[model samples]
Target chain A: MTPKISRFFAEHRPATPCLVVDLDVVESRYQALHHNLPSARIYYAIKANPAPQILRRLTELGSSFDAASIEEIRMCLAAGATPDRISYGNTVKKVSAIREAHELGIDLFVFDSMEELAKLAEHAPGARVFCRLTVENEGADWPLSRKFGTTTTHARELMLRAATMGLRPYGLSFHVGSQQTSVTAYETAIARASALYRDLQDEGLDLQMLNLGGGFPARYREDVPTIGQFCTAISQALTEHFHNDLPDILVEPGRYMVGEAGVVSSEVVLVSRRGGAPTDPRWVYLDIGRFGGLAETEGEAIRYTFRTPHDESDPDHSPCVLAGPSCDGVDIMYEKARIPLPNSLRDGDRVDILATGAYVSTYCSTGFNGFPPLAEHYI
Target chain B: MTPKISRFFAEHRPATPCLVVDLDVVESRYQALHHNLPSARIYYAIKANPAPQILRRLTELGSSFDAASIEEIRMCLAAGATPDRISYGNTVKKVSAIREAHELGIDLFVFDSMEELAKLAEHAPGARVFCRLTVENEGADWPLSRKFGTTTTHARELMLRAATMGLRPYGLSFHVGSQQTSVTAYETAIARASALYRDLQDEGLDLQMLNLGGGFPARYREDVPTIGQFCTAISQALTEHFHNDLPDILVEPGRYMVGEAGVVSSEVVLVSRRGGAPTDPRWVYLDIGRFGGLAETEGEAIRYTFRTPHDESDPDHSPCVLAGPSCDGVDIMYEKARIPLPNSLRDGDRVDILATGAYVSTYCSTGFNGFPPLAEHYI
Candidate 1:
């Protein structure tokens, strides 16, 4: 456990099923990213953890905002983010919201489809818009399907269309997917962006920026390189691809900044064996579930490393099936995680879920089966 | 399309990505339940679309409530439901919430665990509690796992223990799961409850009630028997199994009472055919997604019926992948639903998602990627 996490719990004694975010760690991560990637301007994607406290802290540290919705834009503004510092990053936005964002003086936006481009042209004329270049990325925990970006050929056509429609075809943006671990993915995505930048320039439309969209991996149950390592790979790739004289580069890093900064402390609501046998994975239910946060566990794709008060080194420790405290049977954490849970484990035992700062609260359903969303405690 | 649905849209023309709940249908469904299942007292499960207007309409029709959390219980009370008329239906609850419910004069609650029983025995001394019986319910779209219940032998021991702890072991309960199509599932679950009831009575502890927990079906993409057919099967089984002096039967119908009463009108945000072929699944993106409202589509478990303006007989139509308007890839609704769509369908085209009253708004995430939770429009 980190010192801030230990000290925060010791001082506050916050209730179980609460998310404790260590701002000190968030600052340290930000500092590391700033030091390593000096060329790239960071736009903290607010959807990762749009908590006002996190926003204010990131704002103070001079982080710009990548807002997906008007609500997030409002949140960023509340944290003192100006329109220029905030980009309407979501391409799949309501046409009405386009006008609203334009009215709010948010000029920079991302658009992929002809429909979105038309909406942008009609509503937010002369606005700076980036075309998303689709890249098939592997090794990402959540492989963002081919939903947002487009093929290079299609992207070229869209950028040309954007220029013709009186909108500034500003730049090229690409996302390799969420929790992207492989440094090679960034190198590949940057290379693709470089090729697109050169292609657009060849057509007389000078793409001003290269938006290196987020996929920065956070340390969870998986092994991922540190921010410095990721930055080193990225810096090298940028130097090689851009040939030293680089245009304005931007990154919307969501998970990397906040994922490790927050931890969720949940309570074991029930400890029961499904069947009579000791070998049967002991069914452990926590007070928190997908609706109460930890939604990344949808389909058991991403498993956050956990710390139980019980010692697994004990001989009695065994594999267990974990579930959330809800009437819904789908509220399961794991079918089987071979960890040393105390044989005498009972209700109310604390289970600390680590590295949950990204997409936890924002993904939480309003209230499902009476289970309220996870309460956040920022220290 | 239902007549009321058309009238609702014609009269109001509510914005896309909105929930339109028709009170007339809710009242009509209630009337049918009252007529068919006369012996069973109905409790509207608040977790299924906890809109205040729906609650008030149900309350005005003399319907009781089944609340999952303290917040739900408070909503019921605020909507004019008496404390005695509301049952704390969720088996998994916090000890503090149990205390809060007891303090609020919620006399009835459900418990399945010894840990919860102990908490209840201390917090709410004389509260009437029901022990849930585990059943393997077949033909249920959402099959409830054994996470909330125990076997007959275990439940008997729990009820006996409840009596010893100075709490009223008032009844036995079992759920056949949500969207249960086969009436046989109810019959089988009822038989299990009857056997448990008899065993408890023979042990010198008389059970006062039988909670035939929710599993009632809603009209979706699949074929399901009418409410009358389900009630007949349940009624026959109850009459045969109880022998004489039938206990006060309670049915917590959440989806059944409201599912068909509401419709979600979402705009087609984008239409993209991923592969360059007519056979490729046409990808249609909507303004709302899993995070917005259609969370029952988690794993595509509950496929709600959809109404598009395009003609199915058109030779140009093809199989489609329906997705929500979000940056996340998982916001997809259908990977391959062979629904005919106009190949020319573009952004802002309205698609009516039917029979979505239950588990729609309550299951929606707060807001993801700037798409706000489904706005409720009560007509």
Candidate 2:
């Protein structure tokens, strides 16, 4: 078991389905980011796990923020982050939100369409704005397809509109997608943004900043290159693509900073034999389910590694389908995960779901089907 | 616009992505159920929409509760529901949840497996127990699948064990599935349960009740047989199958009780044309999405009817893909819903999603990516 989980249970017995976060691991991850990408400013995305303790810890680390909403901005400010260090990263936003952010002295913002640009102009004039460029975004576990960014031509027009609307066109931004696995995805995205930056300069709009959006992968069940490897690839790409001059760089790391730092401890409610056939998947029900904060399972598309009380060397284990404690059938966590679950596992035996620090609690439903919200206990 | 929606916006200008529930409509739905199935008892599943105002109104309407957790039992009691009127409906539960429910005076409980029956015997001995029978649930908008219920043989063994363990073998329950469209699905399931009920009686353990679990369809985007049709089919099936005698009838209607009684009022965040070709779906971003209380959309598997400010017959509409304001690509509500969107529809225009009272708020994620939780405004 991870030391944090042991520490959590040792300090005090908690109910089933509790999130245990290791603050020491978080600090180490933050240090790794700065150590590798010395040229890039770090902005911690609060959406992954917005616990106040996490925010306070990051603020103490001198981390900036890539806030997606006004609530997140307020959270960052409350955690001691300066207004200058916060960026309104969401392209799609309300006019009132724009006004409030500007009122709070948040100048840096992002937009992708002229519709949003017009709203910004009417709501908060003369604010620093960045246009998001659409990327191919291949090899990402969670590909950010049509939901964000815009076509290159549309982005150029949006930046031009930003300048005309009296808004300072400060930079260009692009995301390679969340949990992006390939190093080449960033290289290609950087090259595209570099070209756009030079082209905007030709239009007399020389953007001085480049916000390489968050896609930094976390070490979940699978293996990902170290943060240092990702940073080195990005650094080489910047030197090769921007050749003459490098713009001030900013990176938003949400999952990568917290995913490995937390573990979810849940109890098994039932181990029922369903489907009857030996080839059929056995159903293993838990107190916490998809709505109970393990939603990233997303129809079991993201296979998280599972660990039971059995020793790692134990050869006896069972493969089973995992489900949550809700009336809705969609509350399934894993359709068929080949985890080393003990055959002797019964009701009340705790199962450790590793690397669930990010996206679990933040995406939790509020007491669906009489199941209470997933409890979070930070150390 | 729906009358409740207009009245809601008229009375109070709430924030975007809000759920407006009409208690008067809920009362009407309750009366309809009573008029249609006088022999059957109604248990409103609190998981559908557990707004306190809703629970209180239902309590005032003399609606019994099918609680899924101890928290739900507390909510029902707080709303003035007697212990005898409540049933612990969820099959999968923790030991503590069972203990607390028993402590709170709830006795009617449901189970589908020996494991859960054992837990109930240990935690809440001598309590009334109902075994859920697995059914071939077809024509359901949300199929229960393998998450609940058990094989006929397994259920029989469970009931016999319940009697052996000093628990009252009260009934046999089967869910034809939530939002089940076909009346025949219930008829088939009821016939199967009736046969098993007779078999259990042969074993000297006569089941006293048959819970035709929640499957009653609601009028969502499509048409369903009226409550009268469903009731007649069920009533006829019970008489025809049971012949000599029938147990007390119980019906748990979740979505049917409140789906049409509520409307979701959300604002259009962005209306942008992407993908280029006529075949490419236009993207319509909304402040509300799957995470924003409309999770029943189920990755566009469940389409909700929408209304805009445009006249119903302006011949000016577009088929657009709907997405939430979050940066995640999976925040899409619909891939292609042919909403009657005005050609002039822009940011800040209101769009009313109809028949959203059920499953919406219950499955909503809390403040994902800084987007606030869906606010409920009851009329």
Candidate 3:
């Protein structure tokens, strides 16, 4: 019987230091998301592995893009994504990037400050803007209230300023923060945004888009909510707040759209005794380190499933620390996890670290310590 | 008067994140090493930064190189380092890389196993070999007893195996570990390797080199020993062991050669209130992160000094959490460090993180969550 890992290895042997994207999984995920969130438009955040092949696959699945930089915006455009569908969503805007956005015919951009608003006005006088609101959420795993957005009180004034400058404030957006586990956080942000929307309407302002900035958690583990449940809650909140007659909703799901679609495959250079303890042992160090797939969870003990190239029925399992080739002890991915490996695992045993689709390939410290950038292979 | 950061910043203040190298400090460091260890050959480990300009400067100063991979070996060669002056020091070798080293006329390589020796023989028939001995110093901060190097018994056998295969067993090498605080760790490793060298000589093998691998600590903080003292102890030990008739001593000094020569200059994007007493709170998130200069020391709270762009004299000090632009909370460089910043630090304040030369640029993760690579500038 063919092993699951052997199927992947059969298609491609471990290309030394490479990031492999599972196209089948990506396509299935895209279909699932589209099926689940029919009312909402999905925008793939280009920051997660901006390989052209990945971008092209995403675009083919009828996904728009969330671009934070000019380079990202260009990547989306080059990948045949329509400029009108791309949103230049970075709160901070360089004058040159703003001008480039305008030249590229990107209609939507986000602004957080009056200074930024003025700069946007000078660079792109008729750009459509989204006023980012700082929502206070005590329950967020990662609170973003301290950076990138203005308070609700300040956001109202910023929106008014944008109106005075003849900039079209088409939408109101707020990010509950990255990796938000609480579904209630999204409900609260939407309620606050709805109040602001109602207030703006009462004050004789017309708004047509309510972009609840995406933090729909991807299932890094099996416990996270499915996209269907998340979208259902969001749809219910919109119905309760705006009577189902509200503006178009935009959801920018970065990891959710792509996280599971990517896998980082590495060869086991040597399997040796790390000599920590029998219970909580040391590791079987890989060629990749924090410079690769492990960049997603830098300081945390992230769990990654490791399997050998030729293993069928319940491959031999052991808890081993995963370390990189760099001399630094801090260069670890999964400190301790039950990894399934062949009993015959030796030097040159190929291992696949699963479900690293988002934020792994693109964000790693590529040029650090002269370690080469992860080679990318798209299936 | 011109601001200190003005010398590094480009026109229009583009947010091109950069690592800056100070030539004056690097030259002084080189001079200090030359002055103290006049008889010892310094092989600057190219794995530190491997920036072409830095490599060229070190080569010009008569420093040899220690390369870990074919890529690193190629980089040193491209930077004008002769193969004779380069050591293929990494213990594990790919067949192709071994063949490349042999074809390039590079003779010095390290091996820890007989299997590796067999490959080395098949690939590079007449290559000079070094048996990397494992010195198990349990009390040392960096206990590298598990990886790469062979045990004393294994080292002897590997030496014998190489000699049987007609390979020149010319030397013994051992790395105490990175950032080793115990100066005596070197004495221990040297003693063990000396025993191995004598054993090989007793067996009719004439050893010509003692490659004492780098663990020499840089003065990261005032508590760490100065390089002067480190060199003195190692120099004294070599003289004692070989009675001033030592067969060419080679030291691989990576961080010590370049750690103090680099500085990371960044703009403060936001100053947030987090992770300290509410009454006397402390935190400042910079645009740079653990993904940049702090990549080498991920979890540990690194001791670093910071200075304002304009004011260098009044080092307004406070301990604050330094974080990167990534939404991940663990994207912290220093969770706490007394940074000399003005009390009025806000968004757009410029900061220079000093002594980032050695491992900063090389091991950085780029574009995690779409953040761009730190722009690099060499003086």
Candidate 4:
């Protein structure tokens, strides 16, 4: 039987080397997340892939937005998301951006240090703020303890300073890290935030919100936990901390909401022999690269499946290395993957790389080397 | 003493996160290569950032273009480079690209296989063809021997087939590898090409050009060999192979032409405590990341100098890890590097990343997580 992907390809016939989003999957994922994490307010991380369609769907699903820049704020607004629903989440923001956010009626901003608070106080004195606390988790896949975020001591100082400056310090926020494999990291971050929240309350400042910044991993590989499992962990953590009575819980999920809903379709322009020694193996170069379909899989090797047109019976799978159109050797998508292809696979063949939605389109350097991205399509 | 880069930043006030090009250094580097290798024709590989100003300057300096796609071909043309001076050097030829090349009057193209030859023959019969021969270099930074070129045996067959198809097989081309630190690798590739050139003549075929594809390293650190040293080796190799008489030489240099010319200027957005057992180390997070200024430094650690605004003297330097605005922990630029800055460096201070022109701009994922490139300005 022909695969569902093949049928989608037949109907859409997207431009080669282009990103395609399945709106059905996107809506289903959004609905599922909302159903599971009913207490937590979802803020679509606009940085993932702020394509209009994806933004529209998320906003339509009643999700707020997490924007990092003026342009991202503009994109969210253009997609009909209100300024009140959009949080300018960059820890260190420019003065101009602070002014712009104020003018746009954007109330919420993230501050990691006293200097940033000073800037915010001078620029947007009345803006509602979230003290971004630095959660130190060395065991997590990404250790965010070294980057942007305030320590517990620093977080208290910043929160107190915001109150002293006549600004509304709404709550606390912390991100575990992107593509976090461990669910315990979220629980630990929430536990830390809970302690910070209580300490700030003890200092006589009533906080209204606690942002558990999104690092909820989408199931890129089979071994990755499902979104249901992730939501359950968050639920358990929330129950332990607030005992089912919490401030407005916020999550800035970028990849989990949209990553698996997208696919990149590219045509095989040429299938030719790449020379190698008898001992060393060869590669089959494709039209996409680290710049295109495989931006997320940088540093490590990944596997992707492919097949030829017409002869679609999982054509004798073989481990072939796939490279992009660029001359750079590092411009590879898969280091090695057992892709199904016909023995006579030649020019004009097509391949669909599954689950490319989140960062692929948004991160593409289309103007690089003068190669613009192929037009994107949504279904 | 003030650095040469100070002037460029003066005119374009080091926008928090942007790329700056020093044209004086770029032109001098261009002239140095031309002065060293008079007999060899130089083609600037536009795949490494194809910025309009850079292209225009290189073209003005009498450098032909090595374009991989029709888009690059068009960019070169728009930059005032004539089509005859552009070589469509990608081995994988698309039918539309072949037709576009023909329409644009681009005569030179490369192919590694007979299948590609047949397609090109059908699309553009009168196109001047070159067969890319695989150069076996055991010791190179990145071995292209396995990916792009055809084997010498297969190359000969492809050349013969091109002759039969009524296509003019003009020359042979091979890339040893990108970032080739060894000078001997070029000689090895030349020696291989020399054998092929001799065999083609012996077979009664007229070959007019011998393309030695570019892998010339731009000196990032002090240890890299000078351009004059590389040219001396190439000069000696040509003298030994052709006895002072050889085909018109073609060298495609991408990084060497523009790497040192560009600098990415970014601001220190946040500095947090990191990577220590509660005693010492801390990582500084900048506005740039693996996605921005450091995209070219893939797989290897990069050391870049950062200076405070307008204050070069008595710079306070410290080793710190840098990260981009993304929440991903892996979105790091320098995992660790000593950056020079004044104690006044707060949230708003700017830092300049030197030698970023080569592959940084071209390889970036612009919309990744909805972050667009920092506005770019050419001085």
Candidate 5:
């Protein structure tokens, strides 16, 4: 936890299952990215955590936004961001949403298919649109599938078609994946996007931007490469691929900007062995669970580091199956990859899940099984 | 879709990504269960879909409730259910929640471990409690792990401990699993609970209730056994085990009570081939996705049947990868088990996902990726 969040928890002793975010941590992370990758314009992906306080802070820092929906675009606008500073980044767009965004003076959009391109041409006419290129998500913890992006071959055709349909074929974009660990993933994606960029240039279309969609890493159970390392790798790739005629770089980072700034403080609800021998792992249930915002633990993929009050004083620790307080069968967070918690942890004890700032609050079900959404506090 | 829901859609033409539930279907389903399991007291599991309309109707029908949390218990009370008609059924619960529910006059609680039993004894002293026995979840679509229940050997000890701590060991309960398909699953659970009941009786603790916890299936893509078949199997098992010494049976039915009563109407946001061969499946993006309430599609466990506007007119239908309209990678609903959509399907077309009445609304993220929660409408 950040020092600000740690201090907030100590003073307020806020209710359980609440997220405490340090605003200073968010600003520092943004500045680190800005200093490291000076050439790239950072478009904060607001879908990661669209807290009003976080948005207002980023807006004051002059950060652009990459919105996943019309509501997100409005959130950015509501936070004092101008319409020109937002990009509708999701490739799939509803016709009404497209029209609403267009009428709201949002010109930039994204698409990977002819159908979406056609909708853009009809609804948001002359909007600057980017074609998403299909790329590998090898090293990402939350690897994306072929649910998005198109092959470079198909993207070429789509860009040409967008121009013919009176839409501005502005750029090409690719995401290695979310929580991407390997910098090589970005290198590979840049090369693919650059090849497509050159191919489109030869076709008499000058793409203005190369959108490096968010794949930035956040520290969880393991350490990841620093922001400087990612920026250096990205900077070198752009120099090698585009040479003297480098296109304007646009990086949409969601997780990296705010992930480590927050900690989820939860109360231990129940600790049970369920009739097992002492060798068996005990099940530790917390106030928060999959429905309460830890949806990333669907397959035990994002293993989070945990802290309890007895961490230092209690010498004995044991592996336990971590779970949420919901009655749903699938509310389990970590079962296969058992979490080692202090043996003294029991009901009413405080447990804090670290680095849960970005996704936890938003991913929470409004009130699944009658449990309210995860509460959020930005200090 | 039920005629009422179909007609409601025709008349209202409500916004996309909304769930419409027909209350009459819920009543009929309740009546079906009531008729089939005459000896068993039906406790409508409020966690399935705790809509006020559904709860009030069930309350009017003299149905008891199995609440997962204090909020759910409050909802049941607001719907006119007396505290005596409610049972706090979640095995894992916070101490504060136990105190709150006990103060609200909720006397019945469930537990599977010693730790949970102690909390109940201290917070809800003299209350009636039941021990949950861990049973195999064979032939269940959404099979539960050993997350909520204990072994019979452990439960026997816990019940004995409850009695010693001045709490009534009211009953024994077991869940085969959610969306359970096999009739034999209930039969097996009943047999296990009966064996425990007899063992506990021999030890001088008379258990009054046998909770046949919910595992009832909703018809999705595949047809499950009729409710009659399940009730018959349960009835036969109870008779075989208890003979002339029948106990009060409590059946908690969640999904089976409301799954068929609702339909999720969604707009086709984008339909893309993603530059694939003509033979390759198309990607169908809906206004709603995993975060929008189709969370049961996580591992494609609950395969929902779909109805498009072109289903009847279009002769050519092809397999498609179905996804939600969020930018999240995991939002893709069906990829491996491709859903068949009309070849004519495109943007702006309406698709109705069937049998979503139960888990969809409750499981929806508050607003993942800036999309609002799935709107609910009860007719």
Candidate 6:
């Protein structure tokens, strides 16, 4: 937990199953990214956490936004971000959403398929559009390959078609995937996108941007590459591929900016051995689970580290099946990971799930099994 | 689609990505379950769809409720259900929830472990408690066995312990699983529970109820056994085990009660061949996805059939990967299933996902990706 969150919890004693985000951490992360990648324009992916507080902070920091829906564009506007700084980032958008975004003055939009390109041409005529390229998400914890992007050949045809259809084929974009751990994944994607950028430029399309879509990692149970390391690799790749003729670099960072800034403070609801066998792992139920904003825990992909009041007092730990306090069986967060929690853990003991700022609160079910959405506390 | 829902859509032309529930189907389902299982008292699991309209209707039909949390209990009460008609069904709960339920005059509770029994004893003193038994979920589409319940031996000990902890050992309960297709699973669970019941009875504890917890299936992509078949199987099992000394049967039906009663009407956002290969399956993006409320589609576990305007008009069909309109890759619902949709399906075409009344609306993320929670309408 950050010092801010720790101090807030000590003084306030807020209710359990709440997320506490340290705005200081968010600002520092933004500074670190900006400092390291000086040439890149950072677009805060608001889908990660669209809290007005965070948006306002990023807006004041001069950070642009990449919105998945028009609701997000409205949120950015509410946060004082100009429509020009907001990019309609999602490739799959309704015609109405396209028209709405265009009317709202958001000029930049993304598309991968021909149908979406057509929608953009008709609904937001003459708008700047970027075609997303299908790239292998080899090193991402959560692969985003199959459902998005298009083959290079398809993207080329779509971009050429976009210009003919009176749309500005302004750039190319690709996501390595979310929670991407390897810097080489960025290197690989850059190489692929740069080659395509040259091809599109040769084909007479004035591609002004190389969109490095969000796949930034957050520290969870394991440490990840520092922002500097990722930036160094990214910078080196840009130099090797662009030969000093670099396009305007745009990096969308969702998980990285606010991920390490928050902690989910949940109380243990129950601790027991379901089978009553000595060999069985103890089941520890928390007030929060998958539906309670830990949706990233699906398939045990993003393993979050935990902090308990007994962490120091009771040093001994044992394997436990961690689950949310829901009646549904699939609500389990980490059974396969077999998280080793402190042996002294008891019902009502506060367990802090660290690095949960981004993508946690927003993914919460409205009230699954009568458990309300994860409460937010921005410190 | 139900006649009522079809009529509603035809008349209103409600916005895309909304849920329309036919109240008539919910009532007919209640009547069917009641008529088929005369011995079983229906406890409509409010966690499935806690819409006040359904709750009030069920309340008027004299249906009891199995609430997963205090909020659900409060909702049931708000719908005019008496405290006596509600049972706190989740085994994992906070002490605050226990105290609140007790204060609300809820007398019946379910538990699977010692820690929970103690909480009930301390907070809801002298409340009737039922032990949940861990049973094999052999034929369930969404197996719910591992996260809940305990072994028969453990349950026996827990019930015996409940009596000493100032609680009544009311009965035993078991969930075969959700969307369970086999009637034999209920038979097997009943046999196991009855054996434990007799053993506990010999030890001088009177168990008066047997909760055959919810697992009742809703028709999805495939047909499931009718309510009459499951009731017949359960009746035979109870007769064989109890030998005319039958206890009060309690059945909690979450999915069956309303699963088939609702339809999610969504518009096709985009449809494309991403790979640009003739052999490649088309990707169909809908306005609503897993985050929007079709959470049961996770793991492709609950395969919902769809109806499109082009279904008949186009005549020709081709395999397609159905996905939600989220930038996230995991938002893709049915790639493995390769649902065959109309070849002529185009963007903005209305597609109706059927049998989604239960468990769909409640699991929707508040606004993941800035897409608002699935709107609901009752006809």
Candidate 3 structure quality by residue, lDDT tens digits, A1-379: 1144347667657676676676666677677777876767777777756878878887888888888778789889899999988998877655677899899999898877666787788788888898888775555444556655666776787787888897887779988876666777778889999999888877777788888876766555446777777777877888889995778888877766666666777777555442212443435667777665576545443455565755674456565556676545455566544354555666566677766777777666666545678877776
Q: Per-residue lDDT tens digits of candidate 3, residues B1-379?
A: 0133346555435454677776656667777877887877888887777888888888788788888778888888898889998988876666777899899989988877665687788889988998787775543343445555667776787788888897999899888876677778887777778777877888988788888887665555546777778778887777777775677788888777777777777777656442212433445667777765566545453455676754655456455656676545466666544454565676567777766777778666666655677777767
Residue range A142-184, candidate 5, lDDT tens digits: 9774778888888899999999999999999999999999999
- DockQ of each two-chain model: 0.49, 0.66, 0.26, 0.43, 0.84, 0.88
Query: Residue A358 in candidate 2 has what lDDT?
Result: 91
Model 4, B186-209: lDDT tens per residue? 888899888988898889888899
In candidate 4, how many Å is residue A376 off? 1.9
Model 6 lDDT per residue over B26-47, tens place: 9999999999999889999999
State fnat for each of the candidate structures: 0.50, 0.71, 0.24, 0.45, 0.89, 0.89
Q: Residue pairs in steric clash, candidate 4?
A: A47-B369, A47-B370, A48-B369, A362-B367, A362-B368, A363-B365, A363-B366, A363-B367, A363-B368
How much is the lDDT of residue A293 in candidate 3?
55
For candidate 1, write residues A1-379 as lDDT tens digits.
5798988887887887888899888888788888989888899988888888999999999999999887788889899988899999887777777888899999999987777888899999999999888886797889884677777877888898899999999999999888888889989988888987888899999788999899888888767888888889988898899887798989889899999999999888767653434554577778888778777888787788878776664456666777887667788777755445677677777888889888887788878875667788888
By TM-score, the better pick of 4 and 6 is: 6
* Pick by DockQ: 4 or 6, better one: 6
- Candidate 6 DockQ category? high
RMSD of each: 2.8, 2.0, 5.2, 3.8, 1.0, 1.0
lDDT of 4: 0.75
Model 2 lDDT, residue B106, Cα:
93
* Local accuracy of candidate 2 as per-residue lDDT tens digits, B160-272: 88899989999999999888999999899988999899999999996889999898888877889989999999989999988768788999998998888888889998777
> What DockQ score does model 3 reach against the true complex?
0.26
Q: Using DockQ as the measure, which candidate wins? A: 6
lDDT against the true structure, per candidate, is 0.83, 0.85, 0.71, 0.75, 0.91, 0.93
In the predicted model 6, the residue pairs found to clash are none
How does each model score on TM-score?
0.93, 0.96, 0.81, 0.88, 0.99, 0.99
* Native A-B contacts reproduced, model 6: 0.89
In the range A1-379, model 2's lDDT, one tens digit per residue, is 3676687786787887899999888889899999999889998988988888999999999999989888899999999999999999988887788899999999998988777888888787999999888897898888885688887877887888788888999999999988988888889999999988989988999689998898889877679888878998999999998886999999999999998888888898888675334555567898888898888888675667777776465666777778888888888877655455777777888888888899999788887986777889888
Candidate 6 wrongly placed segments (more than 4 Å):
none
